[model samples]
Target: MDFARPLPEYLIKRYQGWRATTYSENKGWYRRLADEGQRPRAMVISCCDSRVHVTAIFGADSGEFFIHRNVANLVPPYEPDGDHHGTSAAVEYAVCSLKVSHVIVLGHSGCGGVQGCYDMCEGKAPELEEKTSFVGRWMDILRPGYEALDTGDDSVRVAELEKRAVLVSLENLWTFPFVREAVEGGTLSLHGLWTHIGEGGLEAFDPASKRFMPV
Candidate 1:
């Protein structure tokens, strides 16, 4: 298998077939809606890994979810300063502009960025500098999680830390004024989800239960 060439062509053809079927089967509903514009009901913040696809996981078709993907599923505290605010900007658009009812922070198992953080915390990796790289900077957001882990086993600790990171991101969402306002006004809800890729199931963070349960 030549990894690059065939895969791109295969996906393009697959999507073309899907589009044709969608138009014909829906009786031109998609065509009409295309002109009317999109109004997605929910927004998902997820990892940019190819294995974890937001739309596929949620069973969403086109215009169903407003998505933002980064190295790890992270939402940093809002800062009005002139930093490159990609995640913040996405959250602002989803909450303020799109007026999405629900915002989900979707984390997953075996995340490379989370693993990198674990490596750094263990002194297996070097401290990140500003000139280091984009991935290093991104993984820094999960430092609090890494520091909070008390488990003895490295693998267990990393997994727990990743889950903790999701909770952290959920709390960080409140840093944005618009998100806070919407949630307080009962117009918006935030959720944290962890995908167990090995099991092919999702564990949703239940605030009432205060634990993750199968979804």
Candidate 2:
């Protein structure tokens, strides 16, 4: 748990060895990306979980995908409170500045933050108010999803809540003017993807089918 300690010597050396190989293998790409700047074809909004890596999951190298990671991959509706809108800023940059053709919201199974939201909705964590933490406020975004669930089985309710939250985020994405305009103009499309971390598989949301299907 000693975070202040430097990386292990063996790991450091291994990374150093890979650096040369990576540079050699991607020399042209690196040179072009650096000179021309990044023009990624897609932008991915995902959860800030160590296990959920956007680049690694999509097999992307530098300048491939613009990424924004936040807790539970939640996208709050546009607000102007002179606050630090990290995720909103990234979305604006991706849609307006980068002009990415597609914006994907990636949700994953076994998400702790999502579970916390579910717990809060069920009144299982009453002491959360004592902490006055930002997570509590952020998790409130899923309140509607939790309230909409009327199931008896706890597991089923949690699963439905998670899926509903993703759908809610998709709706929230349109709250941004840039995202809405691009989608209406056919320049940008929104996609929702659910990843099962244990099995390393993905389910893509199908608007036509009204469900998530294996990808």
Candidate 3:
């Protein structure tokens, strides 16, 4: 059953280059982080899209953020039925253990996962409807957001759905008692953000305006 292989040559070469330059130049910083362990100020739940570089967008360095990436960057409502909950576990650790001051949900434009969800919900993607499709099940988390979207052109609907993904996550995040308590106690805050991948533009959700304004 051995299917694993050595690192790809390109990846290895890149690692060697980074180690020779970045790591070498910041050896002390790396060493301190290794010994002191991570104490990030925020937890960022973001999409698995390679283009959405959270660190690069914020110009953050190592140990600055506790990032968790998943399909569409969705967060499920608190369901402690005892099954595997990767996102929930990360949230618990960040809010309870690490005691991060902020929890940020970041969505982006042209998200493949959101696009799939849009198609699945609109009955445009039959493959995603099968009972065995994990993606279909996962994307179910966004159904509420989909249903709430205003009827509009495909492009606008999809783009709005992307922002709704961030909103959905923020809403579900509060369903966790720990997160709610932390927020109520003024120890932690929740934020929603959306980025235009191509434009390199950012927007923040203002609960007051109930809109995403440019950042």
Per-candidate TM-scores read 0.88, 0.90, 0.99
Global lDDT of each model?
0.86, 0.86, 0.97
Better of 1 and 3 by TM-score: 3
Considering TM-score, where higher is better, how would the candidates rank from best to worst? Answer: 3, 2, 1
Model 2: clashing residue pairs? none
Q: Return the clash pairs for model 3, or none.
A: none
Model 1, residue 203: C-alpha shift (Å): 1.0
Candidate 1 lDDT over residue span 1-215, tens digit each: 55655557889998889878875698566786679887889999998878997887878887889999987799988889997899999999999988999999999999888888788767787754344667777777888888878969988998887798798899889888999999999999999999987788899998997888899
The model with the greatest lDDT is 3
The superposed Cα distance between candidate 1 and the true structure at residue 25, in angstroms, equals: 3.6
lDDT of 3 by residue, 1-215 (tens): 48988889999999999999999999999999999999999999999999999999999999999999999999999999989999999999999999999999999999999999999999999999998999998999999999999998998999999999999999999899999999999999999999999999999999899999999
lDDT of 3 at 117: 98
In candidate 3, stretches whose alpha carbon ends up further than 4 angstroms from where it belongs are none
